[model samples]
Target: MPATCQVRVLGGFGVTVDGSPVPAHAWRSRRAADVVKLLAIETGHRLHREQVMELLWPDLPVEAAGANLRKAVHYARRALGGPGAIAVDGQVLALWPDGCLDCDLERFNRDADTALASGDARACAAAAARYGGDLLPDDRYEWWAEEPRARARSRYVALLRAAGDWTRLLELDETDEEAHRAMMRRHLAAGRRREALRQFERLREALRERVGVGPDAETVALYETALAEGAEPPSVEQTVAVTLANGLVAWGRRNVEEAERLAKRARALALDAGLGHELGEASTLLALVAYARGTWHEQFRQEFADSVRRSANLENAVFDAHLCFQEFYLYGPEGHEGAESFGRDLLGIATAADSTAGRALAHLLLGEFALLSGHLDEARAHLDLSLTDAERAGCLSAQSIALERAAETQVRRGDRRAAAALLDRAMPLAHSSGIRSHLVIRIHGLRVLAAGGLVEALGAVRDGERLLAEATHVCDPCSMAFRIEAARACVRANDLGRARRHLAEAERISGLWQGGPWSAALWEIRAELRRATGQTTQAAALFLEAAELYSTLHRPLEEDRCRGAAGVR
Candidate 1:
């Protein structure tokens, strides 16, 4: 059998044969090693004799170079264990086609190319891990190796950037100016302004220490942007407005306690400043928090009404859009037509303002509404548009939301496999963008539903429940829906205790915030739990109620399911 040979050029140069390192003396002839390196990296592992001579023995006379090439080939063959390892034709030299040769550089390039083509970030990261350093680091000053070294370095850097492995990229080369800029951009995009500023400072210091110069114009501009964004509030009213906006963001992420605190602060500030508009926004945010907490406080309802009245009297298009969104939450399930109309109005306003984020939000809401109404095609169309806008704007949070909702549409359309794939794609975006726990919880719940077998589904539900418990403030409608599904899974697995607990939680939430389209699901799960516990009369009544609710909601499939469960004609 041919001797197995392995060549490694990244970080340094080394060769092994038959699982043992080649003897040091085997590479004593530097020219022979160079010849082998060139052939191994070259396309098809073949190069003409003249090219090799020109590269290695460039300054020698043609006859002398020819003789040197012949001697180097002889040494390379011996080092590789025999003549069969190196093939020499009349004017060309190459590695033997059938020989046992494993080259790290070849493998790295192949892996990188495949990953880049597929746009698989994890695969790209794995490929990038193979790049220990520049090609043949020991051959730093070799003129013949300069171009290939630069090429390899550039490819590796590109792979790291594509994978969003910012920390790893910095570890590989802290002095890389582009990597610094990329990191700053990523942090800023994820709303980590302070981190972006800190990264810029680190880059500036590194550049000044290593090269005695500050960052370039673009890097400096990016730092300035971060600084401007992080600037202190100019006025009390403006500060309160900012606080209210931040609270809204926290609420979206299901951090209800944090949102409540921030909203209270904003309301106090606005009350002191007597800024009606700011106070209105603050009140609206507080109401949103109350809703997320499943409390449905009387104060929340009064505040929501006051905010809507105040916003309607104002000329702020953005505030109007927000108010419209609040209305959707307030009456969406009970008034689908009105909710859809509000969605269209928001879309129009967003488009008029040329706001990608606004447009994406409108599309997401519309898509969700359509999905709830059983308009699968319309849901998909809206979701696709939202995804396009979100991606174009580099809105990672929006992209994750769009993808998660699209996955639900697929699941409802009976394509669990496609839904699973969509969730898989959404997960990285969710992590990178810091998506709210409500969305993440729903994503996990969908994954549980998609998983085959009672055991696997129960395992997923348990894991998701653990995560949900960690986010204690999460009490949104999505959370209620997830609880209902978890209860269903528990029933499927014959875990009556757990199923009852989940069903009770769902019932409590639905009772506090009644009349939503999801109330039907809550009722259906309660019926299932009752049926499992031998409460036949109560189960039948609950099933009939669920069927009535589904029928009112115009959800034919769910209505039929509930009717079947209730044994109705």
Candidate 2:
């Protein structure tokens, strides 16, 4: 029978053989470490031998791979105290049944996920305590291992901070003896003698049993004096911070309406507390939300500038810069200069700060500008940089936008097939993350489909109508613009009947927006629809109007196309 093994690494790195400490050398070789790490990550699940072989020797030929794999297993067994400690049969291996070890990284992952999923503060704290160091710090230099290690480190940090936040909430654990001790001290200061004395004894007894320690000299001294203090504790200045955190979560979840309200409250509280960082963050978030909702560029720019000035903190400054770019992009077609300036500022700030999130957002904004300006290489560079950063950071929302920008660049480069593949890859990430930019991605998806002529006329029309309906529901100008581009793509596919339906929706949105470059493009599509249906006179007049609008917007290529439609080019 195999000896039982207990592997433990949750609080610290150690293993127990039949409830006894096993020396670290018992697990030998980089291959052994790799196997243990991978299996431990999956907990009780079994990894097929082929899978392990492929992971460990991704470049090896099959014949040599099997021989090396066997040698690795042999070495692992010898290092682990012999055949009984590590058993292998065919493609399956199992640790000794009585084997046990401590794994801090594993514990951190399990408990941290629990805390995040359930908002369990206690679990988060436990996970934080377990996360003593990075995953196999001894292996940090291994390039292939850095991604998983970094991910584990980030999760632990986020969970620990969240737990600390909840610990301060009072709602999570009001009966916390620490809170009682705090309450007792406050009561003593407020002249509530009996109440102070009672609270002090309660805390002292609780601490003696739980912590094996009595009240400190200061607390004891307060209890000795009676009628000195006991009133409701001073306003803790906690609400604003809590609300701001909640607002951030809400925004991440794409609940923009709630985020706006919570952020406003946070801002009000920050003002009262004179916390410039919180004030700036809340205000900048509000401005971004405003931009997302199609608020004017001048208004968002003013607010963004004010927030940056208020905080002057790196993160908040980055937020302000990103919001400024987004605002310029969404409003005033002629305001490309603002977008360009903000993108430049963001890049400089991101480089100086060296924050991955900041750099990714800056790249995303710049990529958008590059696409609009028809700089294909520049667009690809920025979009790829953004996507790489976002993917590394596990920021799915940012990654989705980066892919969307890349897809647009691909389309401009006349690589329609590549654009479709890019959209397909990005859509699931956007949807699963519940990102607010799902609307943006979906609109782009429609463009890809229309450009590829993947669906016949009726089917394409139905899909376009459905997407436009959703885009209109969001009432976001950026989303509406993309949807209009999708409509133009459908017209190019020679789906004129379907194009007219999309054109009507575009016309309605244009009327609401008072017309822009997007609206002018939609008019060109409308002319195409009219011509396809043999309404030549009406098409000619509409084409001339579209040319005029495109010329006013300085889109010469688009204006030329519209003029050619009117037979004047």
Best by TM-score: 1
Regions of model 1 farther than 4 Å from truth:
1-335, 534-538
lDDT per residue (tens digit) for residues 1-569 in model 2: 32544454333345554555656676566677566555554455246677767766654568876777777767656655666554565676555534444445556677788878887878777666666665654543333455767787678657755676433422323334455556666665676666766675555434322232334545545544442233543232434534654565577678899989987787767765666545655665676577678774554444443433333233333343243346336335562445667776766765665657666767877887766655779979998998888776566667877887787777766787788788778777756642233234344544544365546433544454455433312334435555565566656666443455456666675564555676677777778777766799999999999889878765565688789889998
Candidates in order: C-alpha RMSD to true structure: 20.5, 18.8
lDDT values of the candidates?
0.71, 0.59
TM-score of each: 0.47, 0.46
Local error of candidate 1 at residue 228 (angstroms): 22
Off by over 4 Å in 2: 1-285, 288-331, 437-450, 454-475, 489-498
